[model samples]
Target: MSFLEKPRVLFYLLLFLIFGVYLSTVSRTVSFGDAGDLITAAFEMGVPHPPGYPLHTILGKLFTALIPIGEIAFRVNLVSSFFGLLTILLIYGIIYKLTKSPLAAFLGGSFLAFSTRNYFLLFCFVYGLALTNHLTIVFLAPAFLFLIIVTIRPSLKRSDLQREAEPKLQAEAKEGRTFPGSLKTFFQELFRIIPPKIIGLGLILFFVGLLPYLYLIPAASHNPLVNWDNPKTWYNAQELSGLKRILTRADYGTGRWTSTTASVIPSGRPAVYQLLFFSEMTFYQFAGLGVVLLLLGIIVLAKKRNWIDLTFLLSVFLIPSAGFMIYTNLSYTDSAALSALERFLIMPYLGAAIFIGWGIKSAADFLKEKLPQFDYRYFAILIFFPIIFHYANVDQSKNYLFYDYGRLMFDSTREVVIKKDDKAVAQPTKA
Candidate 1:
């Protein structure tokens, strides 16, 4: 059978292509902002800014050390590229689970994988690793929860038992015991369906993933040349690595929702303005028709009552975009600030891409049934439209915008310093 018939083969092929593209376009050197600090810290085995991101520091350092062919920054950037590819692979698995059709999953995965937005966001993990990132990934929690639950649900029992049991459970829920009692019972049932092995494996993997964070204590002690916040002592390291600093981002500025830092947009503009700004950014990224397809996909998923998939998509999108709008104090007037905040919307945009795939598939199937003469493959032509457009915008081959910008900034600073020195020399000595 063709690879398409056996989805795993198709997934690997697509993953190879994704990795190749990112590898070719990976940054050659540190660009700006936190990147300089990240690469330096990783290379020197030093602690980074607040939250320390020991995990990222460890991986980046490993990549830098092992990859002898490139600049330190380039090697570190490869870490993001690696995780980015893995995220795309996970997305493909997610879509395949939601829709058994390999073609649909392939299209969904490829659309997001090739898109310009993911090129920067690098899945939600990149956000966590890219210390300068955002809380957008928080929104994906519910989605992941739903995905895990659904995946395990089928393996728990036969289809007949599940269908019959759900109704009885729903009736009990409707009769309503004390809220806490009901909640406890709900979880008890959920736990029963999930295998103990699955639970143990998940816990083990999570903690193992977190082992990288332990690298912070040693890195902090080494007193690296470029250490930020100077987490040298046990007490200071504890404070910086504490929940308060990591969650509230106390290292940079106020961690509160109201705190207006470089990342936060001003609180002056109305909510509608921010909505428009976000909509405009998304439109340009996904294109107009792509947006429509996403909405249609939501409707299609909803009508079919694919609650697990539907809820996951909604949580991923709404929690970041809609919920963030209410809490974030971003201003509508500061175009630069608004534009900067647009990156946080990447997670929601990812949900839109998945929906777009579903919508296209739904439409193709409907048309095929209604109009027997038309080939379903022709409908796939629509999928290529977004890919073509996104590739055109994100084609990074030989792109040196960041390099040029960094050079200009460095030159400007040097000139300013020189001018200051010249003035100091020229001035008459004071009494």
Candidate 2:
């Protein structure tokens, strides 16, 4: 169907277009953090530092060559924006599926995908792939798992009980208390209720999604401008790919905590410290009211028995926010890295934003029923709030920091090299 036929489709397009334009305007030139290495690798068709981002590099190379707009960096930046938009689209689809209200879904999805802000995935394909575009994707696993369990747990238990009681029921068949169905029919019914087939398919798709890692092998062999820990051989490739890194994550001196380490109170700090920290991040992402609305949304979903969506959002929220906080043992000494971890909290922010949308919808529905004459369209104005909040916080359209920063770095390095060269020239005769 044409987009106009579906309000959700139109709203998705509108959100994507607006965000795409904004991201393009703020697109960096030289690079930001790992972005510089990523751009260079992509431009030269080389591998990036450690477990190279094969998919990002390959796709970036194609965009740099073919996009026919702006400089190489700008083109790569556009690729980021493009994917950013796609992520927004995905968020909208997910929210719409839950809320079944176009307006609510739009606001919620926009808040998560664009408003809160956010990654590249292929080094060590599992982690890299998971983190390639956005590390928040990892939150999906917990969310999906929660949804699966919540949706099927009761059914599974019921099926098990029925199976166990089947013999008794069959024995009583002579007394006319027969089993509900024949053995064949019972097996068929049990199969229908079982979630393994669907879960198995999901697992297959998840692995298939990692196929982009295959590109790394070929890209590594070519040896481009910036190949870190060059993965020319299979052994080197695996090493660079982060297989060891994942296993030896503890060796990196990173204070990563997991569910197992949940008991060890870091620095003798109480769990309340983590809760407050989580609260602060959530408050920052969505104001105090938004957090309340998120809780309210959970209540609303529970009331409606929306187990699937509730579990999904809980997964997204808990995995990244609570899960990370439990496992990632950050210290007060490193305010910088801890601040960066705040960025990872975007998953919970996303989950909260979604519930905020639902909360808005539920409130509006209730109010409209109470006051039948009141125009519910007034609630539409709240949509502009998220848009305005996002634009105000994120707008860097006129910032030329990337350019100035790159030039400064280049000049400083050149001067150092020149000084070293002069010192060598003066001393070389004696040698």
Candidate 3:
């Protein structure tokens, strides 16, 4: 077998290649948006804005201390790069596991890594980790649940059937003279189906995951430089209101919905226009080819009667894209609002990438059967189509516009203060 046939080898190859890409393109210093504030919060171990991303802040602090690289801002940016790489690897692993094809996984993972949007696609991963954008990550819950159910369904069914048979066996034993081992056999099957050890380990890990949130309490208590909504303050004698405020995003009025409950398009627009706006955004994702592949993938799954996989993929896509669109109720003409909405598309775009992989595999299989001598792996070159189109748009290497602008403002302010001090000294203390 060729080296590429080994999934482990291919996984490492992807890791190195994508890491290089990320390192080249990652922001050197603070970029726009919450990056400046986030870097300060990470440096000071303080809480950021609403829904204080305790986990992100904690991880960022570790990166900032440990990296010893360029500026502290760059180290914090590396946290985003690291999580983005992990997200890409997860996509690769999921696709490869489902398709059993390295080519498909490569295509799926690369499509997502290189897809162009307002910000890099991985901004969702970064924002989801460090900022208030939780819905992008939250949308994956349904897909994860579906996967868990599908994995254990067969064993669960067998367990249920065995339990039903136990009553009949007991009834038969009551009628008969003997059947001594039925109870022992039933208890053994119960343990086999749902092992206590596994359940205990799962519960332990779940709680461990929640441990990151505890960082908020102590960090907030210090009341560091960039603390937003000091979560250490008490609401009553018993409860910490500031902590509750940060967690619930009470200051932002998070739970309140607007009157305009329509599709992803602006509420005032016609349905046709709204759909056209939505469709245009979708079309540009992978260009026309990606849409075709997405449709083909759906068709392939439907034809194979793979309802579980189909539902999982569709839920991952729709819940983040359509669900968020409705939840946000954003305007098409509002550039800032639309840009914010665009970052949420990463999760859905990931789902589309997987579908594109399936489509690629299906097409490659058809071509191989017709021309037995042809190397279908060459079709992997199609991954570059996205890279070529999106490279110019997403490339951030040497793009220090935000960083330079910030520095220039800081320097100008310092110069002005220095000149004023010099002028005062020149006046001889007003004598």
Candidate 4:
């Protein structure tokens, strides 16, 4: 078999290639936005902003302590690169599983790895670093669901089963079976289709994932320097309320759907503007060719009657894009807020990249039929387009703006003093 047929080899090759690119561009010091705060929080085992990312804090602490290569901030930045790479690999794996075309997977994965937004802020200390950007990570949910359903019920065609059972159900009804009996039979079939153990295991693992949130309580109780919302009290009259506020992001005024007072979306702008902005961002991510492939991929899936995979891609893409746009209602004019909003598009772009892979597979299959002499593997060269186009813009190896600014701020502040609400002042100290 050709090397393209060996997915394991291709997987490692992709990993190596992307790792080199990421390492070359990763920030050597603290980045903008929450980088300084997150690095400090992780280093001191403290908390950052609202929803105090306990899992990221814990993991960042481990990365900072274990990786002795760079400054403390650089180690934390590396954490983002690590997860960004994993996210790319997951997209590659998902595409390969869907298309069974290694070339297609490579192109899709590389497209995402080289995208400008991903490299600049994604692999940096901003939202994409340390999985604090839940929007990007949430896209994995549909991918996981798709894999689980495909693996567990690959041969269990729901339509065929329904058709086969319908006649039996009618016969049973004619024979005077009661409504309750039919309902019981229906549940039995449902349980048979999805075993109880699998459901129980899924629920158990979900709750286990919640275990990390408990870390916030103790971390806050220590009165860490970066603690937000101070969710330390758990047993008093305010039991868990503070923690609940942090977790629910009450400080940011999230969770309400129609909260006009809390919405950041400008008043004159309609909800449809969010959808338009998302489309514009989509076009920016992949450019013309990539977007074409994405559309073609959707068409190919629909033509092939592949509802499951199609739905999976659509869910991941639309939910984070259109769904979030409508939900968050963030204003488009605010550059800072918009910049933050753009990071959330990483997951949607992942979905689009997978579709691009499917489109490539479809195109290659057509080409093979039309021209037998043509080698489809040459299509993999397309991966270099983004790499070449984005290299100059995305490279962050020498980017030290954030690092220098942080140092300057610290050095400029001589004899710093702290005063509490009670007017208690700590002794001044020289910088």
Query: Which candidate wins on TM-score?
Result: 4
Residue range 252-279, candidate 1, lDDT tens digits:
5654433344354444565766677667
Q: Which ten residues in a row have the lowest lDDT in candidate 3?
A: 422-431
Who is ahead in TM-score, 3 or 4? 4
lDDT of 1: 0.65
Compose the digit string of candidate 4's lDDT tens values, residues 1-431. 88876788889889999989988888888777667677878898886776678777887899988998988877888878888888888988999998998889988898888886786443335445433435345545766687778776844676745766677678779989857667767776666777889878989998888898888888988887777767776423443336767777665666543234433765766577888887787777775678888999999999999888888789878876777777678776777557667667766777889899999999999999999999988887887888887887878778888778756755666557343321111133353
Ten-residue stretch with the least lDDT total in model 4: 419-428
Question: Candidate 1 or 2, higher lDDT?
Answer: 1
Q: Each model's TM-score, in the order given?
A: 0.74, 0.73, 0.79, 0.80
After superposition, the stretches of candidate 4 with alpha carbons farther than 4 Å from their true spots are: 120-193, 235-241, 254-272, 416-431
Tell me how far the alpha carbon of residue 94 in candidate 2 is from the true structure, in angstroms, after superposition: 2.6
Ranking by TM-score: 4, 3, 1, 2
- Candidate 2 per-residue C-alpha lDDT over 379-428 given as tens digits, one digit per residue, 9 for 90 to 100: 65655665566555555445567678667656666634422222011111
Output the better candidate (1/4) by TM-score.
4
lDDT of 4: 0.75
Instruction: Note the Cα lDDT for every prediction shown.
Output: 0.65, 0.59, 0.72, 0.75
**Could you arrange the candidates by lDDT from highest to lowest?**
4, 3, 1, 2
* Residue pairs in clash, model 4: none
CA error at residue 241 for candidate 2, angstroms: 9.4
lDDT of 3 at 168: 61
